[model samples]
Target: MAPKGSTFKSCSCRDETGKKLGRKCQRLNRPDGRWSSTHGRWNYQLELPPHADGTRRSPLRRAGYANQTDAEAELNQAKELLNIAANDQALARQIADLITTAVKTTKQLPSPEEVRRKVRTGQHLNITTTLGEYLPQWLQGRKTLRESSRRSYASNLKLYLIPSLGHIRIDRLRVADVDRMFEEIDELNDLITRARETCDPVLRAQVKGRRRVGAATKQRIRATLRSALKKAIREGLTEVNVASLVELPSGKAPKALVWTPERIAQWRTDLDTHIATMSARRKRLWKDTPSQGHGHNLNRIDAYVGAPRPSKVMVWTPALTKQFLERAELHRWYALYYLIAFRGLRRGEACGLRWTDVDLDVGTVTIRWQIIQIGPEIFEGQPKSDAGEATISLDTSTVTVLRTHRAKQNAERLAAGDTWHDTGLVFTDELGRSIRPNEVTDQFERLAMETGLPPIRLHDLRHGAASFLLAAGHDMKTVQETLRLSSIAIAADTYTSLLPQLARQSAEDAAAIILNAEPAR
Candidate 1:
């Protein structure tokens, strides 16, 4: 019956003659069912025992095969796994495609979720679109900022920071971007000091120098940028403060050359002669030249002469308070200097001084308001701070200085007749207008010139005033209070220098106190 209807290829052959073979070659089963032959050796996939939950498991969890049954089972499981993987992948693609379609159809910018979805689906997004959208939302609803501070930040943003960092999406700001920005800042020479020309090209070519900002300006920018970035982080716009991380370029310290008392005394003698000679000539020439030109000429001459600041006005001394009482100058400002030195008035406080603020009868000067000029803008304003409003103690000597100055002013007032400009100010211009501190600095610079001393600024007078008290054995706390300094460190750092002669004098005072106080031992 033809082997029960089976289909098989048979080769007809004879043993040794051309005759039909009664017996054909034995049938061989072709390799099948996940089994393959390698040089007559069998190879196949493996299958593991099922999990306890009746789920099929893989024997060749990673690779290779075990036996026939195991191989068959593994082949079956792998086929199923590959099918499941394909289906899941297709579903994920479908979902992503649907999200993209919905976003595009709705005419909406993709949310962060959509961005992640697009990324997962291998899509690209514009960085600026992603990052810039978050900025305005980030700045909303923030309070606790001062008006002037806000204005400064606004100006900085409009003028500098935004112009540099705008259009660069936050995400686009990588380490490379940071490096490039720093490079740009370097390339433009946007720093505090110019670079030194060196032979080494690598260092010279490198963006090695830090970004340099002036201390006062740097302090302001740092404060503002900190607040801005803190707001950025709070609103989840940025992960870090890049500005905070970058090192600001360092600055050279101020070189101070305060004159010694001996140097000051010598310079003062020379200055007196020059000042007397100049004052006489200046009075005559003052009306003929331009006011600014005259001031400029004097300043330039003073600078060339290397004139020191006024002895009492520019350089302070331990006995400055008492010395000012003795060698009172024009307007007797030395007396005013002593008032602030002893009593802690702002130069404006001293300038704003009134015969009324100075109660010679009671030896107290009441500080209520101050007359000050920022530029040419002049007005009476509240004392710069709360500490500004306080009573200053005047010594009997200060009272006497003031009484004499007041008498002099009074005589001048009478001489001027109807033009006394009775503002009751202790210090005044020739027109009796309140004396500007700039004018004071100008006078100080001229005085310093006249004295044949190194030129010093008027604010140095404030420094000198504080230094004298510290040298005279006052505590930092007392000096701080006396200067109305916001902090003790400010009082100490600007003042406190030890003099060997002062140390010897202190030793002598101690020795004298001990030797003179005790009986013969």
Candidate 2:
């Protein structure tokens, strides 16, 4: 039912003296004292509820409705909006303010349904809330997010989304605005690249510590925006998610490449050239400033002269893996390296493994936890994903190695006595404390160097495990389960690059099968 309001005809007809007669125009009323629809426009006026502060507000007056019915229909909508607040005076004032502002600006009434939803859901009643104002609020409300996820969302909001799209009202944000943000990011990347390549130290310093925002990072930023906007939509803030509509390049992981002879030969040549260049640069620096100590110059050169890998991800051949294990046999964490090389345990998983989770009698090890390093702080958390937490079957060789490691650990515990930390982790330092994940990686790197093998990251040992599994005639599904990957597609895409011998055998087998086939008779 429509609220009490005044619906009357009004016109701009003027008297003979040229003074405009608004509602008092004589033509608005007929001789019988009824309103003449043909002579004037319809308008409605209604007094609104008092403000939250108890002060009176001006009535809502709208002009130029076609007839009385149309004017009453709109008036009913406004009343319905006000009725939504019920006995809550504060809510009534908010609805009243919303209607007044809408009519004044857009010359239209606010949608009653939309207003009711916003009020009921405790969403912001104003449509002018900018991304800048709402993104932080949305992030603050996400209390259940993991620490790493929260950090990522906060970084994307602060570093990209807020700076690019924050000022624009969320409802008014468009796809083009989001596209422009990425375009600007690309431009910034180009600038950073140019700065790094320039000889001027000032230009380089300007971009120091600022890495190029890669496609993967940009995709993550987009995901953060999309998630925030989805929450905003649920809160009735915006009707569209502009972030989802923006297309981006695929952020696929680089394929793991086996360190074959050809690539290794090229890498060795590159390393030699790199070392010579660094040697000349070092001499030039010393010649320019003899006062600087020889040790300082050598240290600086050494830092820069470390050999660069031929690819982002490189896996050792089976022979190289064996050689590395042999060299690391005397090392304290040899079992850790052996497990990662054979069982494909992630560095963090190896660091976090406990004796309780290992079952040599059953020839299986359960992955329950992992030690993660966020910045410099180490945390014990669940595995990377649900699939990452599973029981992996171990071979007899691995069981024997683990048994030896346990014996060594017991001896160390007795030697340390009360000084031992007693972390109970299967892989720990001599003092029984859980080893840092980074320390494991650093030791693997040093071991790989000592064995004089092609350089590969500790994580690449996991990749090598996948290759070995494939080479041993295990199917893709078996490899997926053994690796505890979340999906077979991920296992297929990442580890499908076969080793050289496997590829050659596959090709030869295919050709032999075709050549040996009986011809159609």
Listed per model in order, the count of residue pairs whose N, CA or C atoms clash below 3 Å is 8, 0
Q: Which stretches of candidate 2 lie over 4 Å from their true place?
A: 1-54, 58-214, 276-310, 499-501, 505-521
Q: Which candidate number maximizes TM-score?
A: 2
Among all windows of 10 consecutive residues in model 2, the one with the lowest summed lDDT is 295-304
lDDT tens digits, residue span 1-521, model 2:
23457788889889899988999988889899988959989988888987877888888888898899998888787778888878887877788888888888788887888777666666667687899999999999998886557766777888789999999988778999999999989988887754432223445576664657887888999999999999888877877788899999987778788787778898878777766665566566556666644611333223222567666678887878999999999999999999999999988888899999999999999999888764455778777778988999999999999999999999999999999998889988879988788777767777787677878878899988999899888888888898889999989898887655467755666787999999999
Q: At residue 346, what lDDT does model 2 achieve? A: 88
TM-score of each: 0.47, 0.65
Each candidate's lDDT (Cα)? 0.51, 0.81
